[model samples]
Target: MPIFTVAIPFYNDQNYLSKAITSCLHQEFQESFEILLINDGSSDASLKIAKNFRNCFPEKIRLINLKENKGVGFVRQRAVEAAKGDYIVWADADDVQCPQRLKTIRRFFKENPDVDICLHDCYFIDKEGRPIDKQLKWPKSFEENPLYFEIKRNYFFIGFSAQRAGLNIPFRSRCRDFPEDYDFILRALFKNKKLKLIPEKLSHYRIHGKNRSNRHSYTYRATKEILEGLNLSELSKMLQNSSCLKEKEISLAICELLMTKENFKEALEKLKNGNHNCFYSNFMQGVCYFFLGNNKDSALYFDRAYSLDSTEPSVQNNLGVLKYKMGEVESAVELLKNALQNKPDYLDAQRNLKVASNGRNSLSITKKPLRLSWVY
Candidate 1:
């Protein structure tokens, strides 16, 4: 049996599936590894491409073609079930892997036997395979508890990481969106947190018009579904063991979900139940009150959020806009200027500052720009 099984699942993406499979087939690792390509009922030429690679390397490559259009999670689960290796790696059809990726992961696992999962870095590429974003590095805290960071940002791409086999084959979660990857990793880490990281950029994550993660509303609903599925007891335990300020973060997540649903009262109630000192919780509360048309209470919560984290440019811009709405032009201009100092390219702050300086009616503070949290 191969030492690693690289699981590649493809849907209708015939254009990039060949590139993904070729990368796996050309791995320079001295040790053996198998490529398992699962075709999820693609209406396009995806299956034909998989079979073409399988024909060339019959021993090293295998194919599993599903009859119906099952989702990505289900396809991945099928791939894992059919894998014969001791370790499993992930590969999206649209992403490319570095040639030494398998070799590097093999060496790391051999050197660090205690770690059950390994994650490496990857850079974002455009549709034409040109680098568009810098290499994404996992924060130090994420290195400590990868699951927590996964909740915040799903940076651990299937193309850059591998996990030991014989754990949960089909990772279960309520999330069915593109970030179902996050839910899968969370389940993998729940029982074993012994995750290690390699400091190399080992994959290229392709970003295109079809990237599902760009759909903010859909992604947020999926994430909230997964978080809500976690019982409070388990979630609280996770917070206690993993982080000091995690409760506040958890509360903020819940509040954001409520706010998205326009449950302003419930969002405020949830935020009040945890660390009120958190900049996120306070800011979310301000948002909820602002939406509910309680401008007085909204101003109070915005001030609280500013006091907690005055350095956050988004908060400063938000409060500045609110102050402008309240007829405090001088204070609004000063706050907007401070925000610009913190982040010079903040277009909203610059625009608001310009309006305040010109003594023109400010844009309806109610029409706030998209939340900064969603952009990342």
Candidate 2:
């Protein structure tokens, strides 16, 4: 058995598979590793590409060909089980590992036997496996036996060592659907696996539009699934199901995140059903209404908060500004003046008051509030 077993679950990624496979075959530690290519039901020329790898590196490459496509998670899990190396790893079929990735990951693992998993940062790449212009900083997990709950929440911090990416990056999912990588990570993490992150960017992640959307949608669906499978979910679910204020807060936060990067209509449905509101949401809703020219509805929500909370001068200031924009000068003056009285130096209130009292519509000040400003 090799010291490192690399598993890749491939589908129809013929365009970049050569780069991914060649990267592994030419690794500096090539003598000490084996590449297990799991052909998870590729309908394209991917299988043809795999056959080429086998033909060229017959001794070093192993292929698992399935007649049907499986989801990424199922294939990945199987790849792990099939691994014979001391360390098991995964790679995305289109990703490229830096020259030193294998060397660094192996060294890290040799020195830290307690670490079950280690990953490094990756630069987002184009279809050609070249680094794209943008680069993202990798997040590091906390030390001191950080809770898996916290770790899973910071999934962006996670990475699979280069060795893992070569073989297992292309996984087969039994679900006959894609988005299995998320499921694989969730399952492994939820089991309290030990994972370490290296902050250096050493891999190239490819960008494919369909892959991107499917990955995001899968993440949302899988996260919701994980929440359901959580042993501590009773507490979280209670918050979702309760009528209390904090419960409403938690419910709204999850709903909003779920809505993010998703269909807005679906998000609106969730908001309507939950009947939850926050100052920011109310503010945003009012802004949306204002843009939609639904001034009456916009003013209503603003006033609804106005009657509900008097301590938040910022909200009062917003209402004053909105009224001012709608040509209710006297009403705006009253609210703005009231905001100033409540928080004497709130800059927004002062600035809006200045613009309103000046009796002309011009570009408004676009900045955050400060505690010190004159009423002008």
Candidate 3:
């Protein structure tokens, strides 16, 4: 049997399937590895492309054909179930692996036999296979405290980890709404699995219009699912060893998610148990009050959030909108201008600035509350 199995789940990805497969074929590791391509009922010529490659290297490639279109999560779960190597690595059909990818992963597992997972950064590429001058590095704090960092944001690449065979926890379905890979990693974190980060870009992540990470609806849904599964008692126990995470932070995070779900009173109640002096807690409290139609209380919390973290564009813009509602037009305009200065691409601030400038209060400030990820 091969030392590693690179599983690529395909679905209407004909345009880039060849490049992804070719990258795997060109690996310099010279180790025994098999490429398992699962065609998840793609209507396009993706299966044709996979067949062509399989014909050229019958001994090294395997193909699984599914007649019905299963979502990415289902396809990935099936792929993991069918993987036939000591270790399995996920390879998205649209992404390319580095020539040394397999070699690197195999070497890591060999050197660190106890490590169940390994993560690495990726090179972001455009649709035409050109590098896009961006690096996807995990936060420095992630290695020391995976639970805390994973909750904050997902930075792991699909091919970043090669797990040990027979690790039966299939990728969770609720993750289909979020980036499935992130949720998969989170599940592993919840199990307290040993994770190691290899500080090298071993894969090329192609960014395009079809990328699931770009969909707001999926993000909302996935987050909703994650929040529903979160328990204060369980999380407190998990973070006992984390350097940065604490009970207060976790409570406020849940509070923010509750506010997003429009459970304002419940969110406020949760906030009461957290550190009100914290920037994020204050910001979320402001959001809850704003949605509850208490402009005075909203402004108070917004000001506190701003005082704690003056550089946050979301905080600046939100406070500016509240100031506008309170008839502080000049202050609102100034704050909105500062927000734009901080983040020119912030649509909420830009729209609010224009409305404030035109002396119109028609724009709904609570229309799309910014996610915690947007706070900076």
Candidate 4:
């Protein structure tokens, strides 16, 4: 059996399929690796491109063709089930894996037999494959249940491994829509499996207009469904009982999950029950109140949160919104400016700043509610 199965699944990715396949063929590792090209029922030239690659490298490449456009989850499930390697390394059709990715992963897994999952850092590149200013850096270790962190922000990448791909096969059905990768990480961590982070940048994640993550509304809905389906309270209880996480961390994670479902009151209640009195707790309480239209209490908690961590951009942005609502436009503007000064790319802060600077008249033109940053 091969040491690695590089699984590449595509649907209408005609423009980039060949580049992805070529990168796999150029792996620096000497050990045998197979490339599984899954054609997810694309009507474009993507199938033809895959055929050309398979024809050229008949011994190392296997093609799986589907007749209809099954979603990413279905195709991923198929890939995992059909993988014949000791480790399944995922590679998106639009992304490029580094030449050393396979070599590094193979060495690490062989040396650390206990790790069940492994992920590496990646550079965020534009559609033209030029490295963008942004990059992803995952924590080398976890202070709490890794599931909590995964829920807050997805540090997991497509170019990672599920040892033998066996752990992910059972989660096939839930992997529908945009949350397949997310669902897999959460489920694996929920099962208390060990996940390690290789600090090296092993891949390039392409950002384009057609990227799946750019679909904000659909992504939010799918994410909400997964979060709501999880027994967060149970997960929280497990960490609390084990003393694996502080009460504050557990409460914050629970509150964030509750807030995602718009259960602000429930989140506040959960926060109240815990011994959480930190910046995050205060910030979350402010967020819950802001959503519930209790600006008075919202300001109170935000003020407390600000006092604890004055530099926190979310606190600055949220507090600024509260200031604007209370007719303190100058103070609001200054707070928003501070937020922007700290995080120049803060979209919510930028939007709020525009409205705050222009006064109430712009509100009619925008017709959108003032954006507030949530504490996760």
Residue 169's lDDT in candidate 3: 64
lDDT of each: 0.76, 0.61, 0.79, 0.78
Q: Against the true structure, what is each candidate's TM-score?
A: 0.77, 0.59, 0.87, 0.83
Kindly report which residue stretches of model 2 are placed more than 4 angstroms away from their true locations once superposed.
Answer: 138-174, 212-215, 233-376
Question: Candidate 3: which pairs clash?
Answer: none
Please report the candidate that would top TM-score against the real structure: 3
Q: How many backbone clashes does candidate 3 have?
A: 0
What are the per-residue Cα lDDT tens digits for candidate 2 across 221-312? 65555444444444345334434335555554444444333333444455557675655456444544554557677677667666667556
RMSD of each: 5.1, 11.9, 3.2, 4.3
- The reply for model 1, stretches above 4 Å from the true place, is 172-178, 243-278, 288-293, 306-376
lDDT of 1 by residue, 1-376 (tens): 8999999988899889888898887888988899998988899989988899999999999999998877777877787789999999988899999899899888899999888888887778898899884546456576766666665556656666788887763654343354667677766666665777888878888988887767765776676666555544564566567654556666665555456556788878877776577667777878888888887888898899789888788778888878888898788888889988988977778887888888887543422223344113
> Can you write out model 3's per-residue Cα lDDT over 290-376, one digit (the tens) per residue?
888899999999899889889888888889999999999999889999988988878788889888888899645532335444211
Q: Which consecutive 10 residues in model 3 have the weakest lDDT in total?
A: 367-376
**On a 0 to 1 TM-score scale, where does candidate 1 land against the true structure?**
0.77
Please provide, for model 4 over 149-217, each residue's C-alpha lDDT reduced to its tens digit, 9 standing for 90 to 100. 677766565555545556643544453466687777787777777787677888887888997876766
TM for candidate 4 is: 0.83
Q: Count the backbone clashes (under 3 Å) in each candidate.
A: 0, 19, 0, 0
lDDT of 3 at 182: 75
